[model samples]
Target: MEYISFARLIEAVYLPQIIYTVIALTLSCMSSHRSSTSTELLTAATVQVSSDNQSPNSGNPENTYSDIISSSVHNITVIGVYMVIFAIAGNLMCSYFSGDACTIISTYLEIGGGVPVLYSMDISTKIKTALILSLTAFGGLSALFQSRDMIRISGLSFIKYTTGKIVCAFLCFIFYMMCL
Candidate 1:
């Protein structure tokens, strides 16, 4: 679905930047905590590289490749866990409100799945359009949870991120109404 495709595109473009930012922030925090200057940190990293070059297994390409692969796997596993948690929470919330297990399950198929589901209902067009746009803007609790998990490591305030999302959603709703 278009939603899944868009999600993948967004993830591909933003996830690496996010991971890099987290790493940089973490290193910055650690350096500050230890009273180590950036120069010292750079020197330490250089020393580490030189030491790695001198290690017994340094000549083995397979070892280095496997290390890279393992780290990649670890990152993938963390992402998978985030997805699972998000799915579970979405299901719970959807069930509580809709009281229909089938509809709750199907909405996970795409970002705008709810639009089609809402269309089949007997609701008025105005209410349906409002709900569709609202859902599209909110992007579900799963997205919120995933984003929170991603940025939590950088010691960033989750409240600000959440507020931004809500504000964006509200603005989108307002714009939609103004157009009508």
Candidate 2:
């Protein structure tokens, strides 16, 4: 009886897992190309904002900042870098205007990611899996390329991060197989 119930539970979740796995693999492959473009975008933002010594007269501040944030492209290679950089820029700008950086960043992530929002539960788990893979792959490739500081993830070293990614990817495939 116990074994039969466990089998049924697995069967119920299997198809979604397989779909998630395929999506995760595809996202990982896309992330490789995004890493390079992301690096470039990060570099541009750092140059424009990080230097306190730059003269305010060099260009209109709005243009300088807007250039960093306005990207509508959705290709993983382009949109990945664009959204990350734009989010940082948005947070940085909010801090500059509101005088509270940490609060702004936290709020932005919460609102943008629906992190604490219950509605996020309905979001596709496959997307969550894809995001994890993309982020892990991007961070690993960035470190290998010597831009470790550009993408800072807390609490996990690169090896651990990559290991977790692999485990998740495997589970995603297993989930699919179980469903099939």
The C-alpha RMSD of each candidate to the native structure, in angstroms, is 9.7, 16.9
For candidate 2, write residues 4-92 as lDDT tens digits. 35554444345444555697658756897866665776676666555733656547887656544542222234535644654566556
Taking all chains together, each candidate's TM-score versus the true structure is 0.47, 0.24
Residue 173 of model 2 has an lDDT of 40
- Model 1 deviation from the true structure expressed as Cα RMSD, one decimal place: 9.7
Each model's lDDT comes to 0.56, 0.43
lDDT of 1 by residue, 109-142 (tens): 2344455776675656554554456556666555
What lDDT is reached at residue 31 by model 1? 74
Over 4 Å off, model 1: 1-68, 94-120
